[model samples]
Target: MTSTTTTPGGPALELDDIQAGALMPRPNPYAGAFWGLRIDDRHAGRELLRRLIPLLKPASSFDPERPVSLGLSLTFTGLRALGVPQESLATFPAEFQQGMAARAAELGDAGENAPEHWDKPLGSADLHVVVAVLARDTVLMESLITLAGDALRDIPGVVPVWYLDVHVPADGREQFGFKDSISEPAIEGTGILGSNPHEASLKAGEFILGYEDETGAVAPLPQPDVLGRNGTYVAFRKLHQRVAAFRQYLQQSAADRAEQEWLAAKMVGRWPSGAPLAVAPDKDDPELATDPTRNNAFLYGDDPQGLKCPLGSHARRMNARDSRINGDVRLHRMIRRGTNYGPSLPSGVTEDDGADRGLMFAFVGAHLGRQFEFVQREWVNDGSFIGTDEKDPLVGANEEGRFTIPNRPIRRRLKALPSFVVNRGGEYCFAPGLQALRWLAELDT
Candidate 1:
């Protein structure tokens, strides 16, 4: 049904495009345009989406306060019919090259023997599952997962249940009021780069911060470690929204609108301007959002105890820009991308003044322990990073397990902290290759 083959002296494979017969030379602007289908056949899953996408109409520009189409996500899982060859284990990069080549040739985006391996991350996926998400909200998605997962498991390669679900939404408010989704990064490539180069380089195993395994450091000879030469591990977390509760808390407390804004700023660790207290230290840089060079440039120059940025401020705690060297930033880095989904606050709420919504945090990198967890636990939760009594003023983990925003905007305080972040749902996954998919296809036959 698809055109694919090896040619004499061709280039390596292209792994960016997930749709069959479509190897995008770059990341698609529409990663937001995806769905899930765990079916009786592997090729069937790929073919179905490939055909369906083209037929579907383009998404319309979003309105600030309304629901758009509900979203669904897919990640691969399980192994029944597929059988990978022994040689593939020994020569994965080469095999990965082969598969990318075949898929690219099939796409006609590249000619036969184009000689290109996926510039994006590839080589681990073999299953697909979906998470249905609501526009302007995060609640329904988790509920849907809890609802639909049972039905989906009946499909093939469904064991351990699901692989990756759909992706996390972009951070930002639909109406653009508070600095929405301030922590989200604009992801580049097929996402295989694993968030950022600093942490991604350590994917094969443990590195600088820790090394529990042998292949922890990058190999001099060019080979992968135990996880599979081309494998990548993905962890996803989805939290819920409690607009009414948040509004009630924000309204009843705080002084005036400016004070409310200050409270909001303190909780998030930044003014809506994206300016870090570490540099601006005192004011909001509203213009930074427009200026690329200025927006994300603040660093914790000499302020160890958050003399500039508050120690527990979201920015300082997450990156520990507050932590330092002869003035060098920590080698550990994570490319974080997140989105806010929920109904906007009712303007007329006299009891609760602000809007009702919450955030979705997503990070991609090699070692989860060093990067994501590090930012969350050490800086955000532990008082040591900032030398303050406050934990991550906003995102500290709650007992229920979700990392939802706190009921009130956290302010500087001398007392013990109340956990703000709460967990709703999450899973870890691997984004694999088309060869893996075909290996999957062959099994179905």
Candidate 2:
């Protein structure tokens, strides 16, 4: 008995109790696979969530002949390995109970991106249950990973340690070629709109749990309210990408190859065909980057001196829309999603092909500390609110980074700037809803 809709003014979501990859989008030549699961036993993790709730599918059963979906999340030690109550895990949110590897120095994730150099049951607690799946390729993502490996055949302790497999490359571009998951946010009642039609929507409890957000209140749940109403919190990660040190640091900071593709489109304010250097600032237009209403319709408050983008660009330090930062870009909006893993680097190869490619990011929200750890500690690892202490010159954590670029007859800094994305680990999930996965498979524990 789960159903709700209401949008004319907001608050009523329950799109059949959410989770269709937390608000559907990501099916453009897809094929995914995440899996993690551990749950040593609590009745085999409630019989692997009652055989994955009849192969989960909601968010009003998305479409395109199912385009293949499936999602599920957990951790907070998989809700205390499925037993759940320590006062309902003390009502969740301490940045999702100190997860994401105890907030890795608040997400700059230090030299060689820490968490003791991750990638082992990713930031473990034996990594309890993630299981994603997507599709539209790899033969329907291996027939939904063989029906999620036949619901972990013979469950027992429920292991399946880890797995990755992400995709999207029919020229969708992301092992740093760019065009990644354009922009996302618009949540209100989730008719899913925001690719920036001047951005408004937000408030569906800032992304699902219970309701009313954008601070008109209600953004804290996770107790008996049927296991946190229509849950949502996810984070995910697993980055990596260094595609031959980002194409030999854009061929030693440009002078050829069309100024190294305009210095990788001013450090990614977009145009490996996702357009937008505040709307095609003089180049790569692939027809306005495949025009979806003028590709994320421009606005850095009309380029505030960053000469069409670069206010420490990485999509304008991730959504600084009307520019002027130092907080409140719609209270740090998030919903991001990405996918691309292994094998891509061969176009005029800059070298390092010991390939273990990148990006499997994800975020969804309900305020994991004001939206994904405040956009990974203030817009992708700090740049002094765009004044520059320098980071996010394309996935920060750099050691010798410095990147200004406002230019016309002057500003083009870029010195050194290494660390082309690494941190191969991450987590801080929750996802529930679908009647909170049938109240976590009728938790009688």
Candidate 3:
């Protein structure tokens, strides 16, 4: 159905046409904020979008050494509020139209993830827009927010309903003490693809809309050409991590510090230093982890029996490289950009810290139903494809699940896996291309 050969050439990425947040991560932003707003007046909302256009950051703004980033995404309701026609709105994927709460059961978001427990803005009908800002520190982030507010001062209809902030430590370690953002999919068009030749590059349409997907057909586009040409759907989620419980579990499971680290790596498929277990199975290799060219260069084919990397591990299941699956892996690939939020618990403190902390997960793709939702419902939360019923150890919602780690002496099974990650809230948003923003700004009520 899809091209099996790994094509070295891909469509040239139109960086300026795409929103920066959809393709690349902010350059080491220390602080960030997500502003969720509701549109009270369609005309005012359109004018506000016009005013905000100048502030929208394009994908071209990403500089690995830079210190500033800001971007915006809108819910389907937000677009409708801005005067986008009903015909165009109907063209969006059903998942986006229904919102995240409507399909909680399919996403395994029952119990704590029920709509009643979600943030008010995410579940309420009033939510329209989500503006995300990231910067090197709090002061810079505040300044940007202030500038945005000043731009929207004349627009009275847009009201802020919720604000969530993100905190990334200097060391770049998550609350669970592992290096995050270590692995990401390489898109064909984006020149940002690294020299990790082992991993195959995915089709451009897998991430960006209006491009040919893996099946060699241009992915579906929303009506009114400018509105959906280069835009992509985004699944924004706030995941809270129980750091104390996770650390305590590791401590009680393993006999010593080294074994504890090993158990943790087996669960995550990566060492604290960001070194993947598939490459450095025995110990943490900070050098390899730090090396961009070598860190993501391993595959699962060589160790089919889970010797190098367990098939059910979090990373392995999330992106199963060269693993046998019912369908092509490219079809399910998504651009995952997650940033740490909340303070890190003090080392060696086993008790729960009253402070709340976790990750702000953003999944960018063209097919929300097929790409993001399928991966969440199938790969991450269920392990049936890998011949196991257990979910991902660190983030899966199943507390009764167990993780089996294959070792030379014997396979180790870690049980009583409590849910370490909780869905604080989430929304399905549309990150439009620059032209779409302009089109939205010019819309008439």
Give the residue spans of candidate 2 off by over 4 A: 1-35, 38-43, 47-128, 131-157, 161-204, 215-225, 235-242, 252-265, 268-305, 308-312, 315-317, 324-332, 335-350, 357-360, 367-406, 409-441
How many residue pairs clash per model? Answer: 40, 0, 0
Candidate 2: worst 10 consecutive residues by lDDT? 2-11
Clashing pairs in 3: none
Give Cα distance to truth, residue 369, candidate 2, Å: 19
Superior candidate under TM-score, 2 versus 3: 3
State every prediction's TM-score relative to the real structure: 0.55, 0.35, 0.94
lDDT of 3 by residue, 1-445 (tens): 1112222444555677888767875555378888888999988888777877887777766676755666788898888888888988999888889989887988999987777898677756777988888888889889989987887786778788888888777767788898877677767756667435777777777788777788787777987878888899989888988999988999999899999899999999999988999899889999998887888888888888888788899988888878886567778877787888777888888899688888999898999888888989998898888888889998899768799998779888989999999998888999999888888888875
lDDT of candidate 2 over 48-142, digit per residue (tens): 88888888888777886657888989889888988987988988889888899889998878768888888898988999889899888889889
Q: Evaluate model 2: give its lDDT.
A: 0.83
lDDT of 2 at 364: 85
Worst 10 residues of 1 by lDDT: 21-30
lDDT of candidate 2 at residue 386, scale 0 to 100: 69
**Mind giving the per-residue lDDT tens digits that candidate 1 earns over 233-286?**
334444444444444445555566666655556556677555545446556767
* lDDT score for residue 28 of model 1: 13
